[model samples]
Target: MKKMMITALSVVMAFSLAACGTKSAPDSAAPQTGGATPAPDKKEVTLKVGATAAPHAEILNSIKAKLKEQGVNLEVKEFTDYVQPNVQVFEKQLDANFFQHTPYLEQFNKDKSMNLVTVTGVHIEPFGGYSQKIKKIDELKDGATVAIPSDPSNGGRALALLEKNNLIKLKEGVGVKGTVRDVLENKKNLKFKELEAAMLPRTLGEVDLALINTNYALEAKLVPTKDALFIESNDSPYVNILVSRPDNKDSEAMQKLAKALTSEDVKKFIDEKYKGAVVPAFK
Candidate 1:
């Protein structure tokens, strides 16, 4: 009886020890409620924007690190031409674009029937008159071919620059809408050759002088403030803007992007990097 009782006790002890030796599952390994995973540590917002290559893309690239700290991811798509950015934005492919000024945006909307609007003015890339053949505007020979942008808005801007420099006289009240037909007086008798804005830089040796947009000038390794014979004034109305769809104008992402663009750091970057070729338009 005693041996049977001891055998039963030994059997019970062995079973308990075996059970204790078998490791139980860890608390962390336990199944979560409804089999759902926990949320991520950080929430991220992404904003994709279209911009021109030089200063616009460069500026956006500079702020990427800063935006990341705010849990905002900035994706900048470089565009060579001015048209596609707006098209992409209107089609909802891009969240915003940072290449055009208000005048260009307005004209684009009117012409294309798009609903894009400016979120904020970021920078001003003054149009410049670059020439390899002449050192000064007055040095041009009679009937010297001057290249200007073929786009109506930019063409008018070119005319305005000419009128500002007294090389030509535009019709009264033509202002930003001036065209070749609006030329009232051509004192220099300078012939105007209209080409795509991006091609103006390549035509420097071809034309006596080319009215080059500052962005393209930078891309072609020409500094508007230093290389151009003449440049637009600082107070010029052609300030480059950040544009968004009307519905997204007040979104958090747009606001954050606008803030990042107009931040003092960006202003400093523009001042240091562009060296007056691109000026911060924000106050």
Candidate 2:
């Protein structure tokens, strides 16, 4: 009987040591569940936002700590392509996205049934022509090929910009989703080679000129102010925008984030960092 008791106690002691040695939940994660529903568990909210690498992601990174103070956590995921962010937000994978603009968003919703909506206007990255072949706008040849983004809205933006600088001409009121097909007159007869927005900078060396998006240009280390043959007006309606799901349009999380984006600190960051390539649209 004494031998039996000693064996049982030894087994218990071994189990206790095994339990102590094995990994378990950290003490900080311990539940404080009492009778009263645990005070809502402090509501640890997380927001996942998608954006382009440079200015959009960089801009969000700058304000992430500020957001953490308000009981919010931010995850800024970067994408090289434009289409996925809107699709991700539509599929409810992302909380929000900050890229593209009002017109593009409208066209995307109409075409893809994504139902995406803009929450706030961010900065406009002026579309412009960059070229290793031509030092000035006047050097564009009659049939020289220039690369442009393939997406309809941005293509129109690039076309409009080229026209603005006397590089081409278009029908009146082509708006943001305009393309080369909308051009009523091409005074220069510039042959446009449409490529992905991310690929335009790579085409700069091969083509006489390329109409590059600001974000893509920024990605390729091409600054619009210093490298472009010509640029679009920053005041153009085709500015980049911050977007969210249509259902979440009025959510408090979005409101807090939008307010934070338009704060003076963000405005100052845009003005100082991007120079004139990016401009605060909040004011």
Candidate 3:
């Protein structure tokens, strides 16, 4: 009896020891607490932009590094003519373009039945009148032929500049919508020849005076501040802008581009590199 009781007690003690030796599984039912939430995934973006060669592309290239830092890859396609850039953007071949102003964009949208919008104003290339035959506006001979851009948007700008400098008089409130027919007075009997904007620079010797866009003037190695007879006022409404489709106007990539283009570095770059040829429109 005594041996039986001792064996039973030993078995009970052995089971208790084994139970203590065995480790308990973690409390799987308990909620985890005090840990950081994972960060959101950032989407990588590549923005393909179309721009003019001299100032527009140059300016876009200047911000390539900055955009990269913001996780955007910039692909700048150089365009010599203005039409293709907008067409490409409208067709979704490019993300955005930086070669035109608000007035031109407005006319283009109307003419093409598309919906493109401005992201931001980048710079102003003043419209000016250039001449090799005449030294001043007053020296223009009677019946002297003056060449202007044939496109309605730019032709209107040329006429506005001519009117501003007293070279001619446009009818009241005719502003940017003015045409050659809108001329109220032609005091110098200036014969008007409307030509393509790009051809105006080459026709400098042929015409008494050529009203030229500052971009083409620069391309022809003509400095508006020095060579132009008169230039658009600093307050001119024709400030060039960064443009995109209306739907993409608020996209992350477009917003980043607009921010980078109007950044202090870009402003400084324009002021220094182009001198006064391209004026910053941000301020």
Candidate 4:
């Protein structure tokens, strides 16, 4: 009976110890505190984007601090000409670019056989006709020299603006696709000078008149609302976009940028800073 009692006591102790071990194991393994699990640290990412000097770069600069707070470092590279931005982006030298409109981008993609895509439409820089010598469109003399962008899309845009004001008439239905050859009627016998878009503002005094992009006009200290002889309507179809490759278009960082570019803050900045020269495309 004594041996049986000792054996029973030993068995009871073993079970108690086993139970204790099991209880403590879970206690050490899992936190019993009612706190939520901590989130993993956000990995900071760097995004390199290219843009023109005025509104594009300026607008991009406006959101740099905001993006940094969101764990993205935005590097804005300013390009003087339109071609390099697209070239660099295509070659993977830049993650994206922010200076061209939809027509321009589509034409560029078609012409170069590139597959660049738009991430978001940010704003519109109204195409305008400006001249240092003429205060009014009627003041343009016969045989006056008019400057327009050399690129096909912008050249067509300039021609459309002139045609709207009855400065010239395009071949029927040619619309914004018309070139110098498509001029059905030249009332003033105006000579068309096909210069680069960037050079149009500089040729304001040299050419009898020049059609300039608002961004370039702003860079040359000309306000589109005040200085332009004729400007595109607010509902202009050419909304500038954030262009990127297909591979990175849907990336977390790129989406964040697209969101930032279309945010209310950007709209406010565009309204307050540009007055009417640069209009935000977003609602």
TM-score of each: 0.89, 0.83, 0.84, 0.87
TM-score for candidate 4, please give it: 0.87
Model 1, range 170-214, lDDT digits (tens) per residue? 999999889899999997788999998888999998999999999
lDDT of each: 0.91, 0.84, 0.90, 0.94
Model 2: per-residue Cα lDDT over 139-201, one tens digit each: 777899988888888888788777778766787787555777788878777888999988888
Where is model 3 more than 4 Å wrong at Cα?
A: 1-43
Candidate 4, which segments miss by more than 4 Å at Cα? Answer: 1-40
Candidate 2 Cα misplacement greater than 4 A, ranges: 1-41
TM-score of 3: 0.84
Better of 3 and 4 by lDDT: 4
Note the residue pairs that clash in candidate 3: none
Clashing pairs in 2: 156-178
The residue-by-residue lDDT of candidate 4 on 131-206, one tens digit each, is 9898999999999999999999999999999999999999999999999999989989999999989988889879
Candidate with best TM-score: 1
Arranged by TM-score with the best first, the candidates are 1, 4, 3, 2
- Kindly give the stretch of ten consecutive residues in candidate 4 with the minimal lDDT sum: 26-35
Candidate 4 lDDT at 118 equals 94
Please state every model's RMSD to the true fold in angstroms.
Answer: 3.9, 7.7, 7.2, 7.0
Highest lDDT: give the candidate number: 4
Q: lDDT value for candidate 2?
A: 0.84
